[model samples]
Target: MPKQIRIGTGAGYSGDRIVPAVKLAEFGDLDYLVFECLAERTIALAQQRKLSDPSKGYDPLLEKRMRKILGPCAENKTRIITNMGAANPEAAYAKVVELIEEMDLAHQKVGLVTGDDILEYLEAEDFPLSKGREKILANRDKIISANAYLGAEPIIRLLKEKADIIITGRSCDSSLFLAPMMFGFEMKEDEIERIGKGIAVAHLMECGAQVTGGYFADPGYKDVSGLADLGFPIAEVNVNGDAVITKLSDSGGEVSLRTVKEQLLYEVHDPANYITADGIADFTKIRLEEIGKNRVKVSGGGGKTQPNELKVSIGFNNGFIGEAQISYGGEGAEKRAKLAAQILMERLRILNLKFEGLRFDFIGAGSLWPGGSPSHIPKEIRLRVVGRTKTRHDAEGLCNEVEALYTNGPAGGGGVSRKVKENIAIVSSFIPREKVIPQTKTLEVENGSG
Candidate 1:
């Protein structure tokens, strides 16, 4: 029999349900449990938090997640890999140590992958933002974070060192899984085709429950059962990088050919040339077969060698978005909602409040679909007014106008609510691979000998 490793996804995003992760850690007999929780703006928000309090920049749920799954992982002898470090891997590393000491799992070793933060690199070099030659020097003050999408080489090094728990900041999401596959299979860095095959498996498993029918639900056309207790995904990958995408037999979600195929094409712009930190994978040639119920065998992927330049995500302050909503019901609700929106717009105009951006949506009255779909007129409707501005004062000025509609402008404009939120924008640029030198260090466990 060919050697293989069973890897499971615990949490897909920062706010994913913890119960599924606990289930995955406990019941998904596995070699590694990966939690991919960093979105593009997530690390930027974390960087903001870090600026306010140096020790508080990691994921808020990191402590809770570690407490829940650490013991199960130790019991199953399965290692943990995650990018929950967000903007602060060292602080996250310290927190994990504190948890292990408290839980008395002193033999468990944790490691950190560093050097993803490339703000210093950007400052040293005047790089453009994305495709445009617009230099970043003008908006340098607004930048919160600049992190490179690191590949699996650093992670593979940590796995070789036998770190039971791995923490990283802004790693390429799929690289979290590819690192283990490469290490477990002893696949070298120069093996581009083999690496591409591994990338195919990594991309499928990166989104956690996404591959297990969580996002594959359509009411009549594509119904997925038991979504209330939807189970996460587990990929069984062999030496040749062939994989079987599956879930627990008793788990809620299904892993049919449809789900696997959907996730393969998810976010893939060019099916023949999907780019990543590791290499460019070709999804056009991937073969998918439903060998058994909820078990799909995936293989046959091709690709080009890894890119010479690595992409870096730049997070910056992008002003504020202010929003307010009011509802109207019973008799001509759509008209009432539209009239209320009109009132807010005219009111803001009279107040001489200028906004960077503004929008008025008459929800339940063809807001989602423009030019109007022929659905029955809603018995009730909601009017939402949103504005984006540079200052919080302007943002609040935009929301206050909507609240005034309750009494000053429209009748039955009840259930009024408003909010103002800071918007963190994300942009990308590229840097040479040689510039992003990742380093890994193992955290020492405390009091192991009994």
Candidate 2:
């Protein structure tokens, strides 16, 4: 018999449901509940939020989530880890401390991982940007955010110090789970194969419900029951790096080999040479077995050392996208929808909206596979038009034209909704790992912000 640890995936994305996390904290008996919330788009939006107001940059749902799960997590002694800090970990730290005091929960220690924001340093270094980002570098002022993908070392340090909840900014998703494994198993960095196994496990669990059947439901092919009450995944791992991916038995959804395999390959470019901040995992060598109804045993994950350079996600002000959708329900809905699209295109030229690019999508039609002729005529069709413009004003004008179409023409154009969104472009660049130093700040409620 060897030592084992349970780590639960709380969130898969920034706007993921909270009830699943509450379930994990209350009944999953997890030693750690990690929320992987930072994506390139989310990190960019958070940076914009910080730019608007210095005190308001972290994840919008951070307060709501902390309020709900903090109680159960404290009661069950489940440590929480999240990269909800996004653009500002220090401010996130302050806010969490405030919550701790207001809630008056016994959860005392809170740790913040910082020094990931390498904007100034990146600018000074002028490192070679990835994927034509060097071209975008000419418009340097438009760059909204630049954060390095930090590894598990800082988090491991925080865990050893007994931090109740750790907040991070733009950390590697798998690194969030890797830190706990490395700490619990007392695994060293030089231990290559074990580290790779840990990375493989984290990759599968980081997406939360994806490994449990949230995104695997098909009508008749792969019908997954109790989707309304889908449960998040929990990893039971041993010192040998062997893991069992499962969900609460009483909870909804299935965790068979299909679900596990689907998630394992999700967003993975190279199964054989999957790269991460922790180790280069060889997912090809990984093996999965369905030992039970809702349990899949995972083992035989191989790996190599971490890359010398760390990939940095950079977000910049791309443009504004104005989108408007209107529905048509009748015998000849498809015909009317196409006509509406034509009318909008003509109106755009008349108004001189100055769109950089424009696209028309006819929902319930061939929007997904454009240029393909579809003979099946849909009774109800929704016309969706989106245009990209240089300025927000022009973007608003584009949407306004769609709204105007309702009263002018396109009879039966109902449920017209229009909105303008800031278009943020995310790019990646690499920097020497040694240049980006990750520091941790542990604070307590009674200490009044340390």
* Full-model lDDT for every candidate: 0.88, 0.89
CA deviation > 4 Å runs, candidate 2: 127-133, 371-375, 446-450
Kindly list the per-residue Cα lDDT of model 1 for residues 1-450, writing each as its tens digit: 339999999888998889888888889899999999999899999998999999988999999999999989988988999999999999999999889988887488899998998888677777633443264556778888999999999999999999999999989998999999999989887787788888998899988889998888999999989899988889999888889999988879889989998999988899989898999998888899999998999989978889988888888898999999889998888888888877777888898887988998888777787966347878888888889999899889988888888778667888989999999988778888888889999976865551
Clashing pairs in 2: none
* Residue 380, candidate 1: C-alpha displacement in angstroms: 1.3
- Give a tens-digit lDDT track for model 2, residues 1-450: 339999999999999999999999999999999999987788889988998999989999999999999889988989999999999889988999899888888747999999899888868877554455666578788888889999999999999999999999989999999999999989999899999999999999998899999989888999998899899999999899999999988888999999999999999898888888888999999999999999999999889999988888888898999999999998988888888888888888898888888999988787889765467778898899898989999889878888887897577989999999999988787777888899998987663331
For model 1, what is the alpha-carbon lDDT of residue 26?
A: 89
Worst 10 residues of 2 by lDDT: 127-136
| Candidate 2 TM-score versus the reference | 0.96
Clash totals for all models, in order? 0, 0
